[model samples]
Target chain A: MAGYLNLLLRLTIWFLLTADLSWDNLLLGVTIAVLLPRGATNPGTLKDWLYTLGEVVAAIPQAYKEAFEIMIYPHHHEAITLERAKPRRTPSLLFLDIFLITFTPKTIVQHYCEQGWYEVHRIQRRPTP
Target chain B: MINILSDGCMIIGLVFWFWGTWPLLGQRSVLYKLHSLSVADTLGSMAIVMGLLLRIPHEWPLLLLALISLAIWNTVLGYVLAYCSTREIGHDG
Candidate 1:
């Protein structure tokens, strides 16, 4: 299931890259999408992948809201915090989580520690001293 | 209606560009700047592309590709940039 999801993603990219809907294009795209080397993804279920995808989509509006909040507000207090990862999260999902965190305006995962904590830097609106 | 909407999107996108980029001139940490840049810039570019997509729906394949790459790559690029700069700091200090 994960493999099929990867293929679908690749094929979609292929189609958009080719910008053609011809029968021959379809065949070649499928072939290439299938033949591409797979990355070393830790064992993760398809459900997890889909949930991550859903979160990615959901973050778009959230990103915009954060952007606006940052723009409208006064100076913010920045902080660095160590965040714990979900138990047994695959590397792929971990990467996605980092992406989700960093995609927003207020937080970024500065470093991923071998001890499994994310070194996060964040900004929050606080009253000026 | 479409014309107005597309123009509005582009306008909003331009605002985002300036909002995101204005911080580069300020005294701030790299990661802090990166946060604004990735979020606002990516969303801004996507908004402009969306405007274009609405204007010329025929060129959608290319524009769609542009949107996807902008969304995914820019966010990842922020991480990469942050990773590199922070590593340099760790090495020195």
Candidate 2:
């Protein structure tokens, strides 16, 4: 039920943002058809789900901080501390991904390695960019 | 006002297009070409819509609805088309 609701909400948001009835109707019908069989994926009850949401809320800040450090605004001094920090072979995608991640509020890419591993860090905002 | 902005945007969109279209200059894969074209179309249409918005005075609601619909359709169609082309061509990344 929760998953169904989540899908519905997502689809509605997509519909509004995009304003395409064809895409919106197709996606909505598909979501309903698929979700009817599987129901929900949570192993726990509703209360447990709520608690997990709380945990996720707490983790967001740390994730954003980590992401920022890894991908977006890394300290040059810290780069010295981290000796393994070599240039990435795929700089274009890495840079683009970081820019996209950091462009959003409360998210930052952190600890970006040449191996394409990234950690996301989150932080609270005070309105001024 | 919207007309002027739209015209400016259209000009910029054309610049992206000219750079993206050439085989020799871009040397980009089919997928990248599609992506660039998608960007160009979106930006170009935005400018055209801006011009329409300025010129058409009334019916703001309908105009906006049409604009949003067109943009969404364009994006989804371009993405799917490009994806299909890239898959067929077997371009790596």
Candidate 3:
């Protein structure tokens, strides 16, 4: 099945990244790859993987833009509260979102507010249209 | 040539590390300080690891792991700290 293949691919990558060909290390990586994806509410398909990869690639430039903005204009602090339009976000997606936003220096999610709104603290407020 | 590139990456990483810290001295809110520190820390650490990756290509496995860990754990820690602070404020007031 697709899921099994995905798991195998991830395990292989993990093995390479760890660069340890020992039995113990290989066992650990296999255990993790098998166990973790099983917990995902929706296991990733090839399309999903490709889409996420594209999103990450696109985000690189945006991240750099935000980082430069933070470095150049570091004096101001603006609190912008926004609602999560989506009905629900998976833990994985939420964590990914947080990591992506926080990786850039401009914004940080301070608190998950009532009514599905998130209190995001920002360095610069968006301009009014 | 490789040494020069590695040194350059390390120097740039140090610059990012300092840039992230310079905001801490300011009278910013807790969230603001956390944001600056986390961003700088993550990027700087990754850059340093990248320099190491370049300096010793054979050790990339370890350096890559370091980079990935820095990205994941640093962001998670920031979120945890922010959540705790919010909870404390809610409890008191």
Q: Residues A9-82, candidate 2: write the lDDT tens digits.
A: 45655555555678667777567656655533443344544544455445434433442343344221111112
Per residue, candidate 1 scores C-alpha lDDT tens digits across B1-93 of: 999999999999999998888888899988878877875679899999999999999989899999999987888898889889999999998
TM-score chain B for all models.
0.94, 0.63, 0.88
Indicate which candidate wins on DockQ: 1
Candidate 3, residues A26-81: lDDT per residue as tens digits? 88998898777464354445554455557755665575566666777654646656
Error of 1 at B26 (Å): 1.6
Q: For candidate 1, what is the lDDT?
A: 0.86
Per-model TM-score on C-alpha atoms: 0.93, 0.37, 0.78
Among these predictions, the greatest lDDT belongs to 1
Q: Which consecutive 10 residues in model 2 chain B have the weakest lDDT in total?
A: B15-24
CA lDDT scores, all candidates in order: 0.86, 0.46, 0.70
Candidate 1 regions with alpha-carbon error over 4 angstroms: A127-129
Candidate 3 global CA lDDT score: 0.70
Number of clashes in every candidate structure?
A: 0, 21, 0
**Model 3 regions more than 4 Å off:** A1-18, A21-40, A44-49, A85-88, A113-116, A125-129
